[model samples]
Target chain A: MKLSDFFRKKSSGSVAKDRLKLVLVSDRTNCSPDIMEQIKNDIIAVISKYLEIDTDELDIKITQTEVDGTTEAVPALFANIPIKNLKVH
Target chain B: MGEVIVVTSGKGGVGKTTTTANVGTGLAKLNKKVVLIDTDIGLRNLDVVMGLENRIVYNLVDVVEGNCRIKQALIKDKRYPNLYLLPSAQTKDKSSVTPEQMKKLADDLRDEFDYILMDCPAGIEQGFRNAIAGADSALVVTTPEVSAVRDADRIIGLLEANEMRRTHLIVNRLRADMVKRGDMMSSDDVVEILAVDLIGVVPDDENVVISTNQGEPLVGNDTLAGQAYMNICRRILGESVPLLDLNGKKGLFERLAEIFRKN
Candidate 1:
């Protein structure tokens, strides 16, 4: 209830939940963190041919997302690629 | 024919043996003919947990290897009339018994007992395979820790792959007070992460340790964990028993609301 605590770090439970979500999704997909890094590199290699992407800010990982018209959740590949400019080919 | 269920957790020290002992005892208290098989092989402890270690003259290996009949190897429990335990071989390793022998053993017991529960060993190895080979269903035990939940997910996947689809998750050793204080994961949180149907949740209680040390199942005692195991037995029998309110404060509020509505 303290106002100062509002700016404190996240609770351990939430931190554990987040970590488990990431680990479980990866385990389900058989995609290790090394594989995820390779995937990020592959995406950057392909996308850089068309646009100048900010590789430093790009984020990608496997996570669970609900599908349309279904209550069940499934593993999904999420990517956030920031494009700097279009390459004039 | 009776149903054969396996209690397993991929990680060690997650209360799989304790769950098997209590649930088997609970079913027997309900007057069902129940037999618990310890398939941990070399590292057998169900006998000690059930206080039948001294009575285990012949074990699963003897029965399978034709050394003795199954009737001779089954040690009757000290308390329940219908409860029995088929202890594992402490001297032999996991490779001594094959999955085929286990399947035949389970099939033979199905005609006599109402329920057959197998206490599976930790890890996805030969012991795990042998334990689950004859199982009609599975009870995957896990704690609220990150490592336990992650291993539970792996075990669920393996069970499904083996065509043992009737699997339910038991969240054991949950600290409700810690959960309320945002320091531990709740049962719901674990269920959501594992994506398995929840059969029951056993709160973290010191009574469980005391019972285990005393070589008792804790199903006959008056404790929250004991009540939760009994509820799980009812659920297993196709009865829809509500989950035990481990956090007693919430239960008190519900009782107060009921009293006001009755007035």
Candidate 2:
């Protein structure tokens, strides 16, 4: 018998719980992993139109965590956009 | 005393029919007058799962078509004295039954039964709309898998848009062994994503197949899965019961020690 077969099995509760979270996150955000990457690129491009930024330092991510009994997903964008020391036209 | 419940899942093969059979049987075992209506039309299997296929002389189509009375279409269950089944028509498609027809039928049955459970066909189409039209509540059945959870989320959205008063989750066919090995999704993960009140978490048991094949529901005093079904039934009757803790991963040494102690 396999090593795993010897152990008392864990319940299906955890697996079902985790799968629903990942799917619901994707469903609510309407952003797949690939789409999220594209959205990050778009944000960088839009920000660069106003100021020069360190593109390599830019970060865009969607994080989900449960607080109490409720789960929440937060979308965050961080960028170090540098403005040139010049008077506005 | 009567409540209309729609058993729905946006994806196929998530055990919607099985849930309907077991829950209906469970409710009936509690002496609640329950009627299970198979709304799958041409793809009907509630009759087969409930072991009432051979007794299905009249179907939902006959009742809707006015060819037969609703009383004639309802097949009484031999196992449960208070349970009845309205089998779906094998010859007709889903389009044959209108939402209005279903609503009228549900209204009429509500006066006679304590619970009316509709076995909705899979997909977010006309069949789903028809199933939920008369339902006061819904139970979304899903497995602890990515695809099934995604579909379940979509179904929840649809149910909300329809202004369904109460919607609960029934996570079905969960394999405890696979979950512990990180090969399957967990119930907590599913509940987090769906963000709905959970009705029950049924473990994947081979006995389910055996019981279904034998045309016997898993709510009787025989197997663990049957006990789980009975627990769900009690919850439906307004009783608070703790879920079974099946997540223990004891080692072989522990099992051997326990066996030795028993000896």
Candidate 3:
């Protein structure tokens, strides 16, 4: 088989894997895509209570990656919270 | 020891009853005394699938209500001598039966049979609770579809909450052609999300429909789906069998080759 054919096959496999991951993550967590989006917004709001953070810089995502032939969904909430400058008295 | 297994699915039409019928038949074929119980009260289908609907003179409610003995309610399968069925009551609702009753019924059959398979009703309601009440282990059935998998996840959570630790998964109604064409979910994809040990994988076979309609299980000889059920039966018996990929093109090619050889 040509290299392009090999890459095409791999890409097809990747697409199926990606779809499975997306569906499975939603199923496993019992959180629909809409719910996940709402959760992200909620997290952003909660973080804003203690720290001034950029909402645009927030990276809240549910992702599934394969490691050692096992697929795992890692739900991570990423944010850049600014530290307040305090003067020592 | 009679192992009480509850075959459950959170979503409907994922083949829970079909799995129970075939697997029960499969085990019976191996000379294991099996008792298949239909817990889907008010919507019972196991009797029809097992071809024992006509033989149901007394049902689970009759036994539970003390109107009849358990032995009188248990219908023996004509095809398999060792296999018996405890058909559900069509007129009664799920509330008519309690978890304690189910557990006691299973306990009564424990010493008589090697396997007690419960055909659980769909949803996480009273029916689901009554089905899983006496189960020593649970077999969660799901199709290779998004909705089915989601329901399976929820069922697993419920099973865990009930403290039923021995849980296995069965992914049914998989279409190999669609999986190959990237139109369906593969077995690996399902297992990854469910995070449970898979017991079996059954392909979408027209024979399943034919047998079900005929009120006969597909666990007879000459059916691909039958062979799959046989494998699942062996696995349930604690045999170390490799998981067969029903969606694998290579396996399909081999099955076709077998047909050609026979011809």
Q: Which candidate ranks first by TM-score, i.e. highest?
A: 1
lDDT of 3 by residue, A1-89 (tens): 89888766743434655666666565666777698689878886776676666666556666554456565437543344443433243
Please provide, for model 1 over B116-157, each residue's C-alpha lDDT reduced to its tens digit, 9 standing for 90 to 100: 999999999999999999999999999999999999999999
Order by lDDT, highest first: 1, 3, 2
TM of each candidate vs. truth: 0.90, 0.81, 0.81
lDDT of 2 by residue, B110-195 (tens): 99999999999999988999899999999999988878888988999999999999999988887777776777777876786678
Weakest 10 consecutive residues of candidate 3 chain B by summed lDDT: B243-252
Return whichever of 1 and 3 wins on DockQ. Answer: 1
In model 1, pairs of residues that clash are none
Stretches of candidate 3 off by over 4 Å are A1-73, A78-89, B245-263
DockQ numbers for every candidate?
Answer: 0.76, 0.34, 0.25
Residue B153 of model 3 has an lDDT of: 83
TM-score of 1: 0.90
Best by lDDT: 1
Misplaced by over 4 Å in model 2 are: A1-23, A29-45, A51-72, A75-89, B247-252, B255-263
